[model samples]
Target: MAESDGQERTEQPTEQRLRQAREKGQIPRSKELGTAAVLLSAAAALLMLGDALGEALSMVFEQSFRLERAAIFDPATMMPALAEAIGGLMWPLLGMFAVVLVAALVGNSLLGGFNFSTQAMMPKFSRLSPVNGLKRMFGVQALVELLKSIAKVVFIATIAIWLLWSQFDHILRLSGETLNLAMKDALELLLWMGLALCLALLPIVAIDVPFQVWNHTRQLKMTLQEVKDEYKNTEGKPEVKSRIRRLQQEMANRRMMAEVPTADVVVVNPTHFSVALRYDKDKPGAAPVVVAKGLDEVALKIREVAREYQVPVISSPALARAVYFSTKLDREIPDGLFVAVAQILAYVFQLNAWRKGQGNKPVPLKDDLPIPDEYRV
Candidate 1:
């Protein structure tokens, strides 16, 4: 609901979750659309059957009733029954139409999934609002729809003419054929005609599906600033994020300093730098790492802590500063400092000899030790 730096948001989505869902096949597998398509083909087939059968059925029914010259044939008597029959047939016809609709829904499920809504049926006074009505009247959507309808009409008409002309001779020449042959021919003709209709419909599907997908995607797009706002809604404020980062750094520093008390030595600048190192013969691959380090005032505090804890202290000002600033805790000492550190370590071990009652504490500040300029940190 506010804004955020774009860093926290997803960039190129692999859409892996969506892909996995597809692999799992969670979407509806509907036959409704395909069934509707086939039923539409069947309806065309039925129309052909109806055209050929209507005359024969009417003749048979008339003769069976023997209503040659009677008032029973009169509209006055039969019209009411006819209306009653039409009324009686209406509900079943509606039920059948509902089946066709269900077939369409099933087909949609097969495509991927069926998404349904009834929002259009809500009681909306907006439908009656004059301002909205005028907007709809002149809208680009309305203009586009009008043009689409005209194009549809022209296209369907052209297809109808072409198909019917191609079948003209067969359709007109259906006299000598038996009823069985007639019905069979009609069905065959219907199948081919249905296929032609599908071919004709191909252009509409090809043009519309991709266009609809493109338009829908565009509708969902946000400006870069709007993208930031959405991220804020999902994540949190920038100040809170900054505070979190600060807490993490403080925790890491505290943890690093806390380990210094266990260190065997706290090498220092004697006033302004400190690096605490630890070694274990068990881990020979890594000689030592700076467990803790600090500068200036913090460096003095480290020296005080080392003294209070009675850990050995060695003064190497430049090395202490270099280790404090350049090296990270929990990592091996830098290559340039290794030899110098080893020599200091050797002296410290000899001092260890003095503390063990086998020798005496060596005097401090000897120039004889191989302390080099680059090794001064």
Candidate 2:
């Protein structure tokens, strides 16, 4: 029933959504797996150190019960004896506890790496609501948890019953043995019982791990509109992005138009294209740079700017298109068009001289300017 924009959440969660969930400490974890690991660790530790622990306990009991009149009367002596006995008993058990703790840590880490988020620790008032609490108690997740608990109890009970039933003859024989022999047999029986219980939990843990992972993934499923909205949040909203692009174009156009007034000549494609060129002979190895270029309305604006500054404007559709395409703004024209551009510059200079009454008007501007064949298109 989970939906967004009237569409069900049929799609798998995206990477961004997964990352956010992890940041919020929502990761797949199996409590049953951790419990099984701890139980197994405790059983293994007891098997390995059981004899040492038993001896320590026996020594503590012997010391506590030893009848010494002077020790009983002296509070200091009795206190030291009691403390030593307790410490000796605790040392071996502490080692076993440490092993179980390590196993629990490793089990959890194997499932979800290491996740520490303060957001998960924060209190939520919604959890206190009676209606919400009832919903959670009767939810699918709650039912699954209840079933898992039942299965664990059944498995352990079956294992215990079978182990005890098979060892029934051994249990009866223990009463006829000496005290030391009877205690040894009982310890061995308990060890076997612990191992059987741990073994029974393995199958349950295996199923629970995958079930927890699948359930977590199902909860994070995203709808189509949710995916789109997340994409917009990560990339940017469409309208805002379009506005940014428009602003960038306006800034570039303004910069190009500003350079037109400083150009030596403006090459026009009659209506569609315009490119302004400027050459500085004083600057060594410098070719004419395209100071400005534009199309249509921008081209007309460039021509107006050129005319305001008295820069010459020549209508040469092929040359204008070639220069506009080949040259970048504020960069020199390509070497392939060197001869053709040089001829036009010479013509412009000659025309300028004639207008100053220093030389006769050079041949009138013609349609066939010395344009390179390669640049014609």
Candidate 3:
């Protein structure tokens, strides 16, 4: 199991952790699986190609002895004869090599798929330290490898002893047979023994493959603190994000409060809600826009700023609540409230005129202004 700061690693690795491990060339592999696959493939190839290979060998042997007495003494003729013999065997050897090479590649890729990482290829200077080297030499992995080697040796030895005991009579009969018959018999016996050894490896491969996968996962497991650390690195720390959002909210509130002073009228629910609207006279048909709005404490602050700037403060409970709930800052109030807001704006204009002694005093505004049912909070 993996450990961090004396804490046992108990959590499964995350996708990011697995991906990073792959990037570092850490992946599960079973040497026994690869060995079994290669051996089995070699046995299969030899079984299929044995006749042709045997024929080639027979032909080479026949040619080797068919030389004239005078030609055998000639160096030039000897070299040519040896070259022909070697050339005859080359294709069969190459064919078997190809099959074994493919088997090895396919077997090794069974667990981890294919990965090529430069970091895996790079040598670490830390590995050269005597202390590190000693630890590795006596590690759990080394002990496991030693046990596997001993098991393999024992298995092969047992198979060899059984084959020798069972084939004692056949071996004696081969000695009395003709050279071709003896060679054929020997080849068949060897192929069957090779197949038996390959079969024995199946159990080891099955056991080792699962062990390698489990060991790899155990090595990559994360501790609780490590998981938390990784989360902070990847998704960011929660408290820091909370702080940032708070700062952002404060900045936005400051900007909204600044707009409150510039509003034409500050409509209020008296204590709980406040919505400030501004009309553009230059755009004659344009609806009044909500410049600032707030609930409770923010509402009180907006009202304070409005008084400081000498903006008109109207106590219209329904209208204030409707605008506060339905409209965002700097957006026009909904069409349903257009008539109600227009009435308020007209009263403000007339009251301003009266204050300057330019017109008669306007009538007081009504409390039950029109508010859409859908917008009612």
lDDT by residue (1-377, candidate 3, tens digit) is 54546888899999889999999999998888889999999999889887767877888878977999999999999999999988989898889999999999998898898899999899999988999999899998899899989988998889889988998998889889876777777788888889988998998888899999999998899898988899889877889899989999899999999898779999999879989999999997788999998889999999999999989999998888888888888899889899889999999889889999999999997767777787667
Segments of candidate 1 deviating more than 4 angstroms? 1-164, 167-210, 217-244, 270-272, 334-336, 358-377
Tell me model 2's lDDT, rounded to 2 decimals: 0.87
What lDDT does the true structure give each of the candidates? 0.65, 0.87, 0.89
For model 2, the run of ten residues with the poorest summed lDDT: 178-187
TM-score-superior candidate, 1 or 2? 2
Which candidate comes out best when scored by lDDT?
3
lDDT tens digits, residue span 276-340, model 2: 99999789999999999998999999999999999999988888999998899999999988877
For every model shown, the clashing-pair count is 16, 0, 0
Model 2: lDDT of residue 314: 90
Error of 3 at 29 (Å): 0.8
Q: Identify the superior model by lDDT, candidate 1 or candidate 2.
A: 2
